[model samples]
Target: MGSDSKQVSKIPKIDLSGLHPSVAGGERWEAAKAEVAAALFSHGCFEAYFPSSSDELREAMFGSALPEMFALPLETKRRLKSDDVYHGYIGQIPHMAYESIAFDDPVSPTAVEEFTKLMWPEGNSSFCKTVEAFAKALHELVEIVQMMIVESLGVEKHYDSLVSSTTYAVRLSEYGVPLNQDTKIALDPHKDPNLVTVVCQSKIDGLEVQTFDGDWVNVDPSPNSLTVMVGQAFQAWSNMRVRAPYHRVRVLGKEKRFSAIFFSRPSHNSMVKSPEELGDEDHPLLFKPFSYTEFVKFLYSEEGRKAKNPFNAYFRIGNEEAA
Candidate 1:
């Protein structure tokens, strides 16, 4: 339950076999259900190992050209500016704007190449085909995991129905050097704005998560593996049963760190209503139906600017205005 150096192993691996209702009723279903329940109730996070091929496809996303792309001078990267959508290169978003989500002193862009702005990298049509295929691959996997989560909760229907088409985003985060400051400059503690984030970190280790008993655990990058995190939207739909874990990227050492985060979110107008069975007197109607676009703008505003944890703002746990 806690992440002491000795107890890090206690973090349970997500049981993928339970992707269907029957999976939870089998001999080991109870154990699987308990594991997921504990993860939801405790740390608000869990790790599921994707196949090696998945990792390979993800690696392909960060093509040989990506390095050069991210390596592009900041001036060039700015050319692909995203207006309201923070899709393009983010220069140096202040700590306050993303305080609830990113903990670094000042969130700065590490790298952005010519191709980083596209949904998928550009090359020949063959490469475009592969990119589309890759997106489907990842989407199917997320669906499987989502169903299992629904089954585990003993809900009447799969949670997928509540979601429309999912919106997936991939970002190549380059945490550049501290710019001569004596103190270490890196991202701060925060939760993601999407539904679920599947992060593929480079060899460099700096990502950390808060444990149930209040200890920081380093979530290292494994060869061809993903670090899965639940996000604000998912937590909102789950009605506080599942939580969005608090995490941050700390750029240790002097070298720049490259991390590729594959963000999976539901469509903008998708409604996040309370699960039928989960609606009770205690839980009640905690969240009104909100579009992800609106949530994004809200997050861009003051309510989203106060804390290092996005879940705090999204869930209105402590903010009186949101309440």
Candidate 2:
């Protein structure tokens, strides 16, 4: 709730309990959609109060399942491998305490089962069930958030295809930190390149998002709420109408931090493009249509990191002569 800059406005909070179609009236849904659009454009992130994220669900994930998974031998955890970036086990770096494993299509039962079985070769049905249930619940929130973004942008016509063309991934991370008095920066500041990133953090205050005014704000979310963030691909898809906040995790308190991050991105073969109407006089074509897969390649490449404006440098519509 408190940001470094006292002048910075608090991050917007949206109630998404109106998940059931008939439960929420047309007017209320529309208002929520508008709020989502405004928040993304303004802060590039918001805290969502989703009542469905019960305490039991949170405990199953943060309390036991994740802890046990991380407790596995390093070799056992590394068994879940992948060729894709950040999709497999990543940790045990020289000095960093961060460790993570991501599962694609986490909403599907298969992905969850595969990961669980890999860690527990013989069998571990409980972990599989908990992960599947948690991811499925989170997926519902992601779907509606994406829908709200598209609808608020006046591109509701493309919503169906957009949904179909998306692939989801969930990354679970745990940070190892000593109980030192000094604050430690666990991760550097960076914006996600996907469409949207929704994160559920264990009850530790660490995640921070930068405000438009160049100030960082702590995202202290409630147990029943998930913090949703806009990402670069969505910024481009919305013709730069939505901004992605640069965020990082800091170990303010002397405690290890754990987080579950859910990402919804375009399928590997799908393209990321904004509606022609989005490129009006005020917002001339800032970026061109580019492949999400290729962009991701550049995102993790040396050139991408060196470039000050990676997305624009990679696919901007104008400035052919600048190069």
Candidate 3:
């Protein structure tokens, strides 16, 4: 998805180990918040070091749930379907050796339970528990980052209203080594359509993100860290003040790779609009308020997927319109 021919830099790694809202006015918390804001706006992503997320969670996730779930038969995985676009099992692509399955609203008991039942007809309670707990941890981290971004933009008052209508989807992706020798692009470079995305990568490092200067970055996430990305929805919400990065997975080693990505989005029916504080004389509004659901439908369309600047085509306001 990216060219390593250009200089490869490490994506910004921030230690948000003990962040809390109570310290919002403190220098330490504000410093961390500013770093996060800078990384999101320029690099479009940051590797977060959150100690509260324990090693056991990562072990259980990568050790059992991911391997076991991906081992299931193709037919079994196919049974995990969804009415929503791109929310279900995705596999059988022409070139990519990748397959993924997701549970919408992973934090919801009913949602995870339903997905578990489908994946394991007899009911795999362990998977359900692990998914729920892990998702919750990631959700908390997402909230911290969101709050920081809101505060940085001086729209902290809008935080509660914004998150009140948020929904989440978590997906586990598996990429196997290819038969050929050369490195292969396991996943295409694309920006997610949601507001925020937090990725839990395996010990193996292969994900690459593009920087504002066009350098490709190799992200190596420690057990304590997860890669957090600002998505296209955030671009509209922040009036293009924050960029949604372009990232892709590349596979070279023989070992299989697995990653769990959690997406925080506005509820499907809700509108995504920039806050009043975000639009000003210098930073004009770049998008009209858009429907979270309809925009997803557009990205899944043939035209949307093919465009290099999908948001520019689908939601971005032109210069004249902005003026």
Candidate 4:
């Protein structure tokens, strides 16, 4: 019964076996065990470690390429402003949530200022290579997890085939000041509005996740391991059997921490839903069907409407196809 508490101090890890085969190396196997069924109603978090030997390659792929990609001058980054493609780059996005907390409620003025002055700086050739490699490695890991979920549902021999046409985006973020926050650096508390987030970090810590009891749990970085959690779509598909947890970052201490996050998203045009085993008449559909592009646009809109956050709106529950 090795648990998440046994592994790291402040970080919480949802052991996958809680959702898969609970009996380790046991021969008694059902289509999907009872524990797996119950886990669908509980937390969907897990921890994984990559060997240090692979760290160099992972960093080169995910860590390095990000700044290199973002540093191509304002004009160059703007040129890649992920228009309808929804797959390229977002030059400079304003920090809409926490800005108001520090200044006012409609928080985009000074927030945008800080983001412009700070945030991602320049991209380097060597860094881009490392970040890209890490992204690819993490992508493979997500695919593996998806396949297992498909099997657990007792359907779709190849789960990936269902999501083959999807486009997945990964972001490598560096937050706070370089060991100095009183000067010019700060990030707000906001949950990622995506399907799943796999995060890997350096020595510095800043991540916190909400647990079932409505308490914040800190996620510290392991030397070579990445932390993975379920997102909104997965929750919707399961009719909320799987819930998307809330998370935020707090600027602690003063060491500049580098984190590589691979954001796994459905294709802009794909519709997400749960397996027959997980959905029912009661849970029905809970969200409207919309393209990832539309979802993002709505999220960034000034209308100030509260729709489903990225992490809570997956496998929609409405007849959006007719609309």
Candidate 5:
């Protein structure tokens, strides 16, 4: 789909350096909260710059491990393929020229080792170690971002229990740019199924977000900046006050693109619902509470794939309440 115009709107940028424990209650922290709140309200996506130490870990994953893995032969990559979406390599699909590897529990050493062995067969300890280290670092950063979102909404105290059971996964994606300008779509438009997604992209930019006015704007990749997108769970939790933007990738030319995306969701048993404090008569709970497991099942189902908003099944607005 073509944009209404060639002009692209820049996503908001928020510095997260002040999130350190040493300055949790300081001025910088409040400023960060305000910036984050505005971004979440308007775009549902924003750029976040963390400390240098965190950037090093991000670089190791996107700069080192990802390229090394994607450079491997297709035959070797196929060895890690699985029917399941939560783990292993997924081959390219129509309208997209990228192959991706998913690590269900990125922070788990055993899981990483098993995944690495599946790819290398013989051995690749360094790959496993690097990914595990990167995953752990990113996980910690995701938690910090989650807390910031909670604080921005003024529901940190109410949402404290939910944070403890959050689940995470990391995916390494490489998109091949098409030679033909006619081949426009790299990825179809859709909202992420998780609570939030933090994406670190390689220098090339193809990621685009659909604005409220129905225009697609490119989200240019920046050095040491991770892009964050609010998702369906966040929208539900906020009683639809927050939104999940629909985004897609458009390959410009023959250049290749890569990204390491970390998705954080509530645990399987955690209920996805609007916080009571955020709902009132004017805006009653818009979505019915759903368990994370149920949502996942629907997310991957045939019907879910066809629906514009797969999470609409959980909507309390016009639909009968769940028994």
Candidate 6:
């Protein structure tokens, strides 16, 4: 569905440059917190802008490296394939027109090294190095965004600890039209299974978010900004105070679309539950505590695919079956 430019124009834009001083409770911090809170509660999504220097670094790496890697032949790309959903190349599937390669926790040197070998067995160290640098830069930006999200929810105390040990998975996706002109869903509608998802879309627009009233509105691509969507983990952590908006992608026209999506999540063993500060008798823990691993398994399970909100299925208030 084509997005009404007017509707897309109204999506909130959040500048994260001032998030640091705000964390220490600066003047700018209050305004930033209010902006973020309003955006999350009202729209469940917002466009985020980092400092110009950081944006330049991200654009240089993702803007170039992703296109080059996707341009590789099918067989060459398949060399990095794996059955694991968290890692390796996922070739184009039935409803989706995109092919993606996922790298786990790009900030880790060991993880980066292993991923580089798998992606370029023939020894393209330069490409690997470039990706590592990009990952490092992106990770820094993610930390800032995570803090903003946590602080916006009025849980500023947990910001540092929550983000410090979190794991980030980066996926580079390439979306294109089918040769047969068959109607295929570019990306299906689903809520992310992480705390938050930060996506930098290349200048074509195809992303859409489902509004509270059940209408889908297009998230048009904007220059030098990343579209941030709240994920299931955040919903659970906020005890449903924050929503995980369902979103999808569509092919707009002749051009192929590319995006660098970073999924931010807690450590595998970290227990995800609503912050006690956010709960009371009125909203006594809406979700049961669960680990990231349990959550991931549910996301890939049959029940998860069928459930409208997997978080609810797994931890909602007393469905006898879930209990």
Query: What is residue 30's positional error in candidate 2, in angstroms?
Result: 1.2
For model 6, residues 208-304, the per-residue Cα lDDT tens digits are 7777666777777766677888887877778777778878876758888888787788776788766788888886766667787777787788997
lDDT of 4 by residue, 1-323 (tens): 21212123333333332222223223332323333334434546655544531656655533554435444466644433334433334323454111110111011233323333333444243543344455556666565455455556666443655567445665545564423343222454354556666777665676666565556666776566677767655555444555666566655665445566766666665766555555467655554445655655554555313544323333332543211
Ranking by lDDT: 3, 2, 5, 6, 1, 4
- Off-target runs (Cα >4 Å) in candidate 6 are 1-7, 18-24, 52-59, 79-86, 178-184, 316-323
lDDT of each: 0.57, 0.81, 0.83, 0.49, 0.74, 0.72
- TM-scores, all models, native as reference: 0.73, 0.91, 0.93, 0.65, 0.86, 0.85
lDDT of 3: 0.83
Across residues 1-323, which tens digit of lDDT does each residue of candidate 2 receive?
A: 33543233378998887575334338778888888888888889999998777889888888888998999999998888776766799987766678998879888888788888899988898788888888888888888888888877888788877778899999999987733324466776788989999999999867888888778878885779899998888888887778888888877665777888888999986888788878888778676678888888887889888877676667753542211
Q: Count residue pairs with overlapping backbones in model 5.
A: 0
List the RMSD of every prediction in angstroms.
6.8, 3.4, 2.6, 10.0, 3.6, 3.7
For candidate 2, the 10 contiguous residues with the lowest summed lDDT are: 1-10
Task: Return the clash pairs for model 3, or none.
Answer: none
- Give me the candidate number with maximum lDDT: 3
CA error at residue 253 for candidate 1, angstroms: 2.2
Q: How much lDDT does candidate 4 score?
A: 0.49
Cα TM-score of candidate 6: 0.85
- How much RMSD separates candidate 5 from the native structure? 3.6
Better of 3 and 4 by lDDT: 3
Candidate order by TM-score, decreasing, is 3, 2, 5, 6, 1, 4
Flag the better candidate by TM-score, 2 or 6: 2
RMSD of 4: 10.0
